[model samples]
Target: MSGGILEGDRNMGLIRAQLRRQRVLAGMNQDEFGKRTNYSASTVSAVETGTRAMDTPFAARADEVLETGGLFVSLLELARRDGQPRWFRPWLDAERAADQLRCYQPTLVPGLLQTEAYARAVIRCDDKLTDAQVEQRLAARMDRQSILNKDEPPQFVVVLDEIVIRRVDEAFHQALADQVHRLIELAERPNISIHIVPADIAIHVSLTGPFILAKTADGGWVGNLENQLGGIVVDKDDALATLLSRWETVRNEALSRRQSTELMKEVVKSWT
Candidate 1:
């Protein structure tokens, strides 16, 4: 086997060992641990033995029950990093460590802000992914949201195209409503802001694409461009500058925070 495969197996083994050890230290048998985490004993066993991959929800619940102080969450991230394309890992690292995040989404709702149902619906659109793969991806996406709950969460500013709110399907009405409510709740946090760019805006730099610019603790910036195929981490000075320029232009086209909130409320009302 190739080195990459070998490394992945090793990392997975570490996760399995860590999870079993933590459970034992907590003095809980597999059945007891499963009960605490709201998973079946067989499912817990599968994860412990590496027959199944750990999902974000399971990791979070395990961390809480085991009092591991986020250890399981860290392991879950490492496992996810191992599975992702190499080009995406640096962006993931930047996202976890950044002091500030600026994002523009012209398509669907941003992954960080999506509700579970909305996320499931979005992931289901990909015909290539199997049910298990979809579940794993959903768990990882949900886990990333934990960053917002951290004591010193990053300052987040997100700009969404107005069409994103209006594009929801009738089947997702309730889920979309919950998602909009979630956006409203998150926007209320002093460190987070959400803006909506009017659909009528005839011109904007974000027309180029959706991107995120993260400001790291060491006063450096990293950018990411994401699309259907995959994601690219941007670190080159010229590229970063362009992304920042586009972000500013898009933010200028978006409504103010209060206006965006009111608009979102109006949209939520229409979901019924």
Candidate 2:
């Protein structure tokens, strides 16, 4: 439990260290601590070792278990803001608070729908990322999917370019197959819908990168555009309007839900 297991992510490091110390002082191993918190030992180990991002619910549970009176919760709030690069925080907040998320991805599945292995394969594309950084991000991405399973989760309308499902990478072959199955499972939920833009689509307007428009509680929209570098949050009226236009165009190009699922099933067989 020392020397940058999480690669000197001090904010995360401090959280993990403190949690570990508390469990030790209470004479509880990870399995014992996990039982008190109603989680598994593996989950406890992941959090304590910084391989998993400690989520808010777990923080609350920890506070209750260790009688820390919300100390873990407070620390987690800071970790949430500072754990990742500064630029991504605003949209992360917006996404968490959004009631409706409209997503369009041209090359991959949206983060909200990606399976754990699929997310890991995608994040590994960045060679510069350390193992700790990748695990941190991968955990965060998996945690983000929880929003869709919450009580009365948001209405998620996702449109993906056909290649997202059709394109196969030799390295990600198995992960991609599992991802398609995950997509189908999630789409079965009433709140989730997946649409696919067929390969025949020759439109260039939607080629301007993938973007998501989230309708916040205040009835305004926030946009997140992803690229090779990072993501940008869109809030200005004019910029949001342009995103709206682009979203509408690609969404129109997408097949209906049933048709898209059928197409995905056809592509899944190709994996074998």
Please list the C-alpha lDDT of all candidates, in the order they appear: 0.84, 0.84
Spell out the clash pairs found in candidate 2.
none
Error of 1 at 249 (Å): 1.1
The clash tally of candidate 1 reads 0
* lDDT (10s digit) by residue, model 2, range 145-209: 87888897889999998888877768778888999999988889899999988889877687878
TM-scores for all candidates? 0.83, 0.85
- What value does the lDDT take at residue 209 in candidate 1? 85
The global Cα lDDT (0 to 1) of model 2 is: 0.84
Best by TM-score: 2
Residue 156 Cα positional deviation in candidate 2, in Å, after optimal superposition = 1.0
